[model samples]
Target chain A: MGKYYKTTPWVIPELPQSLKNIFKKNGKKISIRKNQVISGNDETALFSNTEKLIYIDSGLLGQAYKTYCVNKPYAMSIVLPGRMVNYLHYLEIDNSGDIILALRKSDIFTMTKSQFDGITEKDLKDEMVRYCKKAVTSDFDAMCCMFTCDTPQRLAYFLKALAESFYDDISTMPLVEIPLKLSYAEMSYIMHTTIRTIERLLPKWRSMGYISTRRNSLIIYK
Target chain B: MGKYYKTTPWVIPELPQSLKNIFKKNGKKISIRKNQVISGNDETALFSNTEKLIYIDSGLLGQAYKTYCVNKPYAMSIVLPGRMVNYLHYLEIDNSGDIILALRKSDIFTMTKSQFDGITEKDLKDEMVRYCKKAVTSDFDAMCCMFTCDTPQRLAYFLKALAESFYDDISTMPLVEIPLKLSYAEMSYIMHTTIRTIERLLPKWRSMGYISTRRNSLIIYK
Candidate 1:
């Protein structure tokens, strides 16, 4: 599974500059350290009770969805810099168990429902709809790919997507390589497999000169 | 598996009347027979080069997602009346292999991109965004449930969902029973399993006095 992320050419997108500009101009910004859990579906995720537009300034934010059969949740989405965390929550169509934690120290902005509504020009709203729906659609596609793809293909995609999430720019071309905001346990959790599976795959990939380890992140050399 | 829909309480929603009002008042309506394939990601799904908003007027619509491992596409969404199909395509974010077909003789309306933009009031756009995001989120959750739930539970959810999709109103309560838009082969396709499995489950469920056949649809008796 670890090897699959290397071979997969799938690239996750960064938030677009236009949308970023809207947030920067009107949204309140804040920062949080790594491992902090930013959640919803109980009390408000933000200090405010209104719906919000969240812009990730930096760092990795992870979300997972669980089903009845498995005790573990499958990694649903990974938010990198320049994107909002929960558009559905903001839109108020549904509220989900947020449980998205900052994998690294993260900088983010929160624009309340009023602020977002005030800035809701038709063009911007159109763009937001496009981005949010695409986020949900492709994220589901990725999950489908993850569970159904062979271990090798799954690992390749997971790594490529992980590396791609670091940049503020969204692209589709294959990346050269990057990782650190992951541990073996986290990898198993994100991949929705067992720690034993992650442990078994890491050594083989490491010996094959496919990946390396730093302080906390796994760097793909391949 | 066949009995699960009877045991578990899961209900699919029909399209809302408000949305239906918007489509009925402003969009062009057309009808297609059962099994008609309505597609995207290739030649235009609509005659116009521009994107269009689709509102199902009547009958069931089926969409499936395929991954690398499985040869079959998983039952992704079953679209009922009043709601729009492929909002991402309408919004032009990403295009998928529009494999959604009319499961029954479906009457639907097509509102062009320009038409949509023209009618895009702020409140309406917000509602649209909310609806689309919720559709994607819960639909993905449904897939997660399908793949992860035990066979009995899996079949239960599948059948209840199948029945609920026939109506235009979306609900979450458990359904009493209904069926007929499904064949065992189609059941295998939607459930992402073998026909043999469908064959194996039907009789056991029948003997248990759970389901019976009408002219076309299966009627569930809880």
Candidate 2:
């Protein structure tokens, strides 16, 4: 299981800026500051508006789902820049689905299904499909890790995934120092464990010379 | 967590035999016997041809993936009739992806992506997309259970899910005894625990007046 835990997710290329720029221009671009929470609920609309397809252009979006015991919900997973958050549907009036919070100062844009469907141009639609397919594969890999690997193995798998998400072609490069600019608290959220537990395991990994932590970021040698 | 573990998956209506019959007519139907393993490999084909959308019409299909220490691959989860298996992609020529086994005498049909995408008629395409969306939500619920719940909670969740999968509208009836036709061995495989552990747990549930085993099947009272 030594090399099995080292399983890295398939590399996903960043969505082309040209296509994303069109979304930014045509749709709503919401900027969320680090550590800020975006409640799905709006005061005027009694229902949580989940009608938009979200594109993460920058920073991290942590999806916090409520647990029975914990007073504060922890993030079960993360979405990095170039990742798309789609395909989740919650009950119509219920407030219990996902609470999207910015793990970092993030910028995200939303496109409605109608807007997506209205694109009659074949070329643009084909390009969009290609990008969406990439996101789907990334989702599949993350999900495979979630279902199959042990917890520590899951953490290791995701750290490498997060690094690769940040750097487009980090997987192809020779042994190099890749800076993973995510905090331990965020890592805790991702792993669904306490920050203290992450602290214990991370240093054990560092002592074993498998990885290193630098200040707020991690130096992941791939 | 008591009420929480009683979490029943939202009822999925059996794919209308009307629609499924259409799939059966257009695609190749393969019958797999109980306990029979279908290696993706054919004698001559060097590559595992995963280029099909499998629609299960009846019986159970258990997907087993090899673990590091185990000599026999244990099923991680199950696919009941009305469940559609899509969106998994294995590496080309790699035999390490999935080992599909019939948990019962199962009949499944496959439709190529080309066959799926070739439907240009608006009404038929719309119906197929709606059915596909329903399948996606079922996948989502199952995934949420996997990621968020504890082991016992997950087991409880899946048992209710399995019962509902076997009988449509099982969720609607009050205090009904729903028959779950899966065996303890299959339950052990699904939970990634030993059959001994399942034997230990089921009797405890029985003592608590929660469930009862009848021959090889289970009677789940909801």
Which predicted model would earn the best lDDT? 1
Docking quality tier of model 1: acceptable
Off by over 4 Å in 2: A1-13, A39-49, A65-74, A87-96, A116-120, A168-175, B1-13, B38-49, B64-75, B82-84, B87-99, B116-121, B167-175
Chain B of model 2: TM-score? 0.72
**Cα lDDT of model 2 by residue, A10-118, tens digit:** 3334667766776777867888787676544434321243666677788877655544435335435676576555424311112245566677898888776568658
Residues A43-115 of candidate 1 have per-residue lDDT tens digits of 4244322355677887777665534344664444567677775665554545453456667788888787667
User: TM per model?
Assistant: 0.76, 0.79
Residue A140 shift from truth in candidate 2, angstroms: 3.3
lDDT of 1 by residue, B34-131 (tens): 87666543352444223566778878776655444546545445665656776655545454534566778999887876676577687776666656
Poorest lDDT segment (10 consecutive residues) of candidate 1 chain A: A1-10
Query: Which pairs in model 2 have colliding backbones?
Result: none
RMSD of each: 5.4, 5.1
lDDT of 1 at B55: 78
- lDDT, candidate 2, residue A108? 84
**With candidate 1 superimposed using the best TM-score fit, by how many Å does residue A215's alpha carbon deviate from the native?**
4.1
Q: Pick the TM-score winner.
A: 2
